[model samples]
Target: MKIHEICFSPTGGTKRVSSMLSRALTDETVEVDLTAREVDFGQVELSPEEVALIAVPSYSGRVPTVAAARLAAMHGNGARAVLLCVYGNRAYEDTLVELRDKASGAGFKVIAAVAAVAEHSIARQYAAGRPDAEDEAMLRSFAARIRRKIDDGGLDEPVIPGNRPYRKAAGAGIVPKATRACVKCGLCAAKCPVGAIDAKEPARVDKKRCISCMRCVAVCPHHARRVNRLLLALVGRMLKKACSQRKACELYL
Candidate 1:
């Protein structure tokens, strides 16, 4: 049986956690990058004997819309899926349950689930430098348990936390844009997972298409793309209390 690491990470946090889990599971693993704008996940087929680790970052208590769309296009072909929802130290809310349902809907059988903490893609102050030593240990332990379960031919579905008909995504109305320092390098446009930015112009952004995943901000070499500082401050203040307390990784096997 093979392992597939399918990840949608806008700011690298989700990818980091996913990688740890995949590596711990086995040395032979193939990756499916959900953030690539040019790739279609539908073409990536999975066999019944394979297993997939579907990892996605939670956005406003739910899966990012663009990521969900990309995931829905995938063909699981009855492979077992281990669902993971990585959040920015706040709460995964319905992200895990939603992912479980989505993966199952796409033809994967859900075997286990996890909700992990990562540094906020926007608010760097919370859960900063995480998936640290402690987090790494947790991931390894969980991977060991998973390895045992699969070896025993256990296919029992895991019961994960979250609500169906998930919470409405009331996203923070903070869209980032290129500042005067922007050199019009077009890198953001070329790399945008949703193709929201115009490749030729690079300055203009299609707000309607943007999911506020912060990929552009994190990828900018010149530090040009940024959200409004005043808005970011307000967001920081709003999340400060909830994010101040450190949360531990939760696993459901």
Candidate 2:
């Protein structure tokens, strides 16, 4: 069956995780970039005979609002989907469940789900080099199991994680700030998914439009952009207990 891999990854963490899983599942994969600016969601179409491996990063415990909107515009064409939520070492919270619901609503059968960890989007120290060798090995094994289940026609229910009423969407603060090293190259402004940065002055961020995805921070050539260092340090300390170990990638097929 054809495999459709759809994802929204700004800094490439989510894309990396999704690519690993896609490679394990099938060599015949079609990719859809949900992060493209001026995306025409109506252009995307899936076929009933295909299987879709849909992945997205958890932006503050929820799907990126813009990505969700783009996903909603597509017709699944009866494809069965493997919903994946890739996150920083932090918790995925309601993202997986929300994705499941969205995929189902788009007329795709929910056959499996996964929560994979990648380096923190804002703070790189956490989960660095992840979907690393260990994670790749685990994903390969999970893909084999998924293939077996499909072969057996096993469409049993899978337990997806999340509460019935999802936690409220996280606040949209934590805007990235540029350091003295910035060259005013405007790369961040050009690459921002939401036009949050001022194109003429790369260092100037439009806080109201920023989603705190940290795309600018990750893409900066000079490593000039960063979230508030004090805030990140405090957050890191508070979450240290919860972030002690990287969790194994799970599959529900």
Candidate 3:
């Protein structure tokens, strides 16, 4: 069966996890990048026969605004979807339930859900280098179970955890800035999901537009993009307690 791998990964962690699951599910796959600013998401339609592995990272215990908007615009057309929410060793909180609502609203049938952990976007130390070897094995195992359920043809939506009125989305306030080492290569500008960085200047960033996804920091060739040291440290300390424990990948079918 053909599968659509729809993802809104900013720093590549969510994409990495979803890609593994999709590849395990089927060889025939199509990629739908929710981060692509040029694409009109409303025009992207899916058939009922197809399966979609829709994945996104949990930002501030919620779905990123841009990802949610892009996803809501897609025409699911009653397509079956397996929702995946990747977190940074912290809680996903309302992310999965919110995704379920969005997918259902867009006409997708939710069959299964998975919550997994990846390296923290801002605090590199937490869940560092994850969707690691063990994560891959478990995710592939989950894929097998989901495939069996799909083949059986009797599917019931799993109970996704979260509240109807989701918690307020708190900002990280960790906008990345180009350091003196920046060479104006424009790579960061081109890769920014929100178009927050200026292409010509490369150093100037629109704080209002920036979602603090850290795409620019991750993509900069010169490794010049960085958040404020004091702020990063403060955030790191705040996250340390919740992120220090290793969280296991979970599957709900």
Candidate 4:
């Protein structure tokens, strides 16, 4: 069957997880990059003959607002879907359920789901060097199981996480700022999904437009980009227990 691999990855972690899952599933894959700056939601469409592997990063236990809206705009054409929520070692809380609802609403049949872990987006030290060989092997086995289910037409009731009324979206955190080490490079601005950064003056960031994906901080060559350290510290402390534990990557098929 045809495979459509859709993803929204601001800091690369989500994309890395999605790619591994897609590779395990099939070689014939079509990627739908929701992070593209010039996306036209109306242009994305799926056929019933295809199987959609819908993957997105868990942003504060929820899907990114823009990614959700874009996914909602697409017509799934009755395609069966494998919902995946990739998170930075922390909790995935409501992401899987929310994504399942969104995909189902778009006319896709929910056949399977996964909650995978990658390196933390904000704090690199947490779950560093993840989605490594071990994780890849696990995902390959999971894909094999899914393939068997699909071939046998044995998909059972979907088991997605989260309550009926999903949690509300979290408030935007402090926007990242450039430090003195910045060389006026415009990479961050050009790669920003929302055009939040000023290309001419890379230090200038539009707080309202920034999604706090930490893409700027991760991409900075000079390590000049930083968010409010105090806020990050607080977040790290709150999620320390969850982040500290090395959770296994999983698949529900």
Best-fitting candidate, scored by lDDT: 3
Error of 1 at 121 (Å): 0.4
TM-score of each: 0.97, 0.93, 0.98, 0.93
Q: What is candidate 1's TM-score against the reference?
A: 0.97
Clashes of each: 0, 0, 0, 0
Q: Is candidate 1 or candidate 2 better by lDDT?
A: 1
Candidate 3: residue 196 lDDT (0-100): 91
lDDT of 4 by residue, 29-130 (tens): 888888887878778888776798899989889988878888998889888888889988888889999898888888888899999999988877788998
Candidate 3 residue 149 C-alpha distance from true site, Å: 1.0
What TM-score does candidate 4 get on C-alpha atoms? 0.93
User: What TM-score number comes out for model 2?
Assistant: 0.93
CA lDDT of each prediction against the hidden true structure:
0.90, 0.85, 0.92, 0.85
Q: Write the per-residue lDDT of candidate 2 for residues 166-248, one digit (tens) a residue.
A: 88988777898999999999988878888989888877778888888888988899999987889989878877777768777
